[model samples]
Target: MTLEHKRPRLEIEYCTQCRWLPRATWMAQELLTTFEKELGEVARVPGTGGVFEVRLDGEGVWSRKSDAAFTDAAELKRLVRDRIAPDRTLGHSER
Candidate 1:
């Protein structure tokens, strides 16, 4: 019998005190729409003290505080796609 590999899970942790839920939700929606089949799940985690991070399988992929900027939708898509589906084309998002 062949074993099936599990898809990657995305976690977006945003600061609740900073009111970043809308941002996190937007990012989650974008990721879900872009990688609906490639991703196993997308989770929104509540945080504090200006924390905004994205992780795949518990590994940090992007951090707003560290980067000093919010991650763009296309950039985040590329980052996630590279890890989950390296060969997959992102069409207009490539630019």
Candidate 2:
């Protein structure tokens, strides 16, 4: 199998009622673009109650409620990179 099959999947769960689809999709796009070869897929999940969480292979990496803030693009990249491609450098994102 190719690396694509072996790569981890990233999921962004956002509250539809909160109108967070744009934010979720933006995060997904950033991840997919950064880790084009390291990720199996990026999915957007709809939820309610102001939910905004990022999951890697079914495990939570970032949460809005508990984390108390939305993960910025750089932080999100670092979180995902640590899980799926630990050794991969993220250039300016690392700074």
Candidate 3:
């Protein structure tokens, strides 16, 4: 029998001091809903100093400070899909 590899975990670090929970949670929800089968988990990590970063399997995928802007749901989904399920289409999310 072949072993099945586990899906990648997604971590979203947001600044609690900056009150970014809603934004972070929303993004997490979107990712979870979109990749319910492909993702292992979507963790929301509390952080400070205006932090907003997304990671997959410990690899940095996106950073708000570095990008100088928040990533929209569609763009973020595309980034995640490219990493986890490149061939899978995101339907309306792609448009």
| Maximum-lDDT candidate | 3
lDDT string for model 2 (14-43, tens) is 999999999999999999999999888999
Quote each prediction's TM-score: 0.94, 0.92, 0.94
Misplaced by over 4 Å in model 2 are 2-5
lDDT assessment of candidate 2: 0.91
Q: Which stretches of candidate 1 lie over 4 Å from their true place?
A: 1-3
lDDT for each residue of candidate 3 in 2-93, tens digit (9 for 90 to 100) = 33778889999999999999999999999999999999899999999999999999999999988988989999999999999999999998
- Clash count for candidate 2 is 0
lDDT digits (tens) for residues 45-75 of candidate 1: 9999999999999999999978987979999
lDDT of each: 0.93, 0.91, 0.95
Error of 2 at 3 (Å): 9.4
| Cα deviation of 6, candidate 1, in Å | 1.1
Global Cα lDDT for candidate 3: 0.95
Among residues 3 or more apart in sequence or in different chains, the pairs in candidate 1 whose N, CA or C atoms overlap within 3 Å are none
Report the candidate with higher TM-score, 2 versus 3.
Answer: 3
Clashing pairs in 2: none
